[model samples]
Target: MAYQVTLQPSGHQFSVQPGQTVLEAALHAGYALPYGCRNGACGACKGKVLSGRVDYGATQEGALSAAEREQGYALFCSARPLTDLVLEVHEVTAVQEIPVKTLPCRVERLERLCHDVMGIWLKLPSSERLQFLPGQYIDFLLKDGRRRSLSLANAPEEDALLELHMRYVPGGFFSEHVFNVMKVKDILRIRGPLGSFYLRESDKPAVFVAGGTGFAPIKAILTHAFNQGLKRELVLYWGARAVRDLYMPQLPERWAREHANFRFVPVIQSPLPEESWSGRTGHVHEAVLADYSDLSGVQAYVCGAPAMVAAARRDFVARGLPADEFYSDSFEFQGGPGT
Candidate 1:
């Protein structure tokens, strides 16, 4: 049996199968709902259930608190509606059209962006072409049927190489192999182009908030913007613990110098005394809020740690930034063998 699901405000309607989650049904019906970490670890898929009972399957307690559940909030990615439902969710129209694909790729190169961050490039088979949006991600299929997710750091261009920024997690099976054992020419299976985070084509000014290596997708989006000759004002706020963590600092600086509409702000949460640091300091999102008090006309792309992404979404929306205009991808590492 299928249950009718209606979205509030927009009044868009879709049908959900008995076993499918709200998000799956919405996506299947061509409605792109805001989401990240579809596994229910991140709260990015949270939405208000207006008038239906839903069974939230295996959701982490921290992802949605008891108080939130009592208030009719549910994670669309994990919630299965029991009856016809009315929901309130922010839909992203721009990214709704990106297609998804699964393909095999060979490792072409591995460049160390930092001590712990590696820029892994994969070359698609000559017979295949990977069609994906700039800020989407692909999941690496493991031998045991498990998967590890990583965002693309390069835009879809004529070049058939897909770039990924992988952060090394000590004791992680995949990270250890990637840093110590993985080599060029290795064939890896991937299923992807998932997630709703992407550049929304708009004339409004853009604020890009990146934490740690979350800069990967943002980099792809920025490059795409530059290639397309987007004239909208852009400010990139990249945050890291130290100067060394801000990998590819030169790229943003060079981009800002070349594009009159672009500005780069590298923020450090902690700086060594000998580093002679002089720039924005403290939290990266706070820096944006301090500089641009009125976000009523700005669009923000936030990608990074779950904490940072969640905080920015709440604070920025409260400060007049339209909730629909704020797109984000929260990187959540499942502490497993191949995470």
Candidate 2:
């Protein structure tokens, strides 16, 4: 059986399938309901039931008090609709609504995603949670009074461990340390939920272009879009110097296979001599240009080298894409070791 659920204020409606928690249904329906630790440990998803009954399922001992439940409040993360329901809850629709936090985190795990890219996972204190837009980044506060900014590679909903993709820069400060010295259990200070490069709500098709480690934030954005069950046509053009540079290609390949609305195009600028390759070649944006002559109706999210971003902006706008609909974030390697 299924229950119809309506959200107050926004009037957004979705159906809650049996055994699905209200929070799960809302997110699967593209609604951004505020939540933390979906396991019912946090009360961040608590809201008024408005007009119907729910079976509060496994709410932690202190998360939903008896008085709170009696007053018609339920933790959406742990509540299941017993009848058609109307819920009054605040939705996270803008970046400003989330707070920027500076917290201490331990390097929980690390993996070499590619020859030059080191994947780092940071675990925050048990009581701390960082809510961020999918494509935002964080600044790692280094001991030498320097800060290194890296886009978060994981979505807010999957916040158990924050993910960062760091590309090694020869003799560069942070990247070298990340590759050579950083280890699990190392304490690092970070401040963020920063940057404004996030997905905008639109019915237009989306074109994502990523270069090098710039794939980090784009991966997060795409995952969030998928989780929301977005119906818009989505495509990605990931550009790399060689096949080896395209780290984690299988994940996007999986997405292309699973999401009918999605398409993935990998463009390699140069392939190794021994590597027999057949795929799109040249600039990543050029692949988009070849497929799309008119971008007037689509939204483009691009991240990568400054030169590529500039070229895409110029060419895409010339192709009729609205300037405002083009969103981008670019990174450059500094001489001394910064991203």
Candidate 3:
């Protein structure tokens, strides 16, 4: 059985399947409802149930006080619709809506994703949560008064373990430390949710071109898009030197297999004989250029070396992609993100 769930003011409606919580249905229907600790510990998802009834699935007593529940408020994260319902909630509109935070995080896990890419997972203090747009980044503050910017690779919804992709740069201080000395439980200070490279709400199709670890930000963006069950079509072209260079290839491949609206194109620059490579070869942007002659109708997000970004932007616009629709963030091996 299913019931219709409608948002107040906007009157946007979506169906709540029998097993789905209100929050789950809302997100699946492309609605961004504010939430924290979907486990019902936080009241961030609390909203007024203007009409109809809910089961008020499991939740902590203090999270949804008895008096608050009596007043027609329910924690949407733990609420299940008993009938058609109306809720009052606001969508996150801009960066101002989310606080830029400076918090200490523990190195929860360190995973070597490839020869050059290492995945870092940071765990925030139990009492603190960093609210950030999916593609935003954080600057790790070093004791030497320097900062290294690392993009959050995980989506906002799965933020319990904030994810970062670090490429092993031989002479880079931060990358060298992360690959060598960083250990689990190492306390790190950081300030962020910075950068403007977030997904803009658009119904237009999206084309993403990622180079090396530049896929970090795009991974966050696309994961959020998928979690929201967005209807827009998305095509991603990730470029690398060889098959081994394309770390985490299974992820986008799985996304392509699972989502009808998603497509993944792995572009290998050059493959050696033993590689047995038969996939798309050459520059990542060139693959996009080959597939899309008229990108004016779609949005293009490119992340790579400065030269690649510049070339992709110039050629994309020349191929009819709107100047405004082309967004890019270039990687700085010596500096950091957005530098």
Per-candidate total of colliding backbone pairs: 0, 2, 0
The residue-by-residue lDDT of candidate 1 on 248-303, one tens digit each, is 89999999989999999999998877677989899999999999879999999999
Candidate 1: segments with Cα more than 4 A from true spot = 8-19, 56-71, 94-97, 333-338
Lowest-lDDT window of 10 residues in candidate 1? 330-339
lDDT of 3: 0.82
Tens-place lDDT digits, model 2, residues 166-247: 8888888787788889899999999987666888899999999998888999999999999999999999999999999999
Give the local distance difference test score of model 1.
0.86
Candidate 1: pairs in clash: none
By lDDT, the best candidate is: 1
lDDT of 1 at 63: 62
- Name the lDDT value of residue 110 in candidate 1: 92
Ranking by lDDT: 1, 2, 3
Per-residue error (Å), model 1, residue 191:
1.4
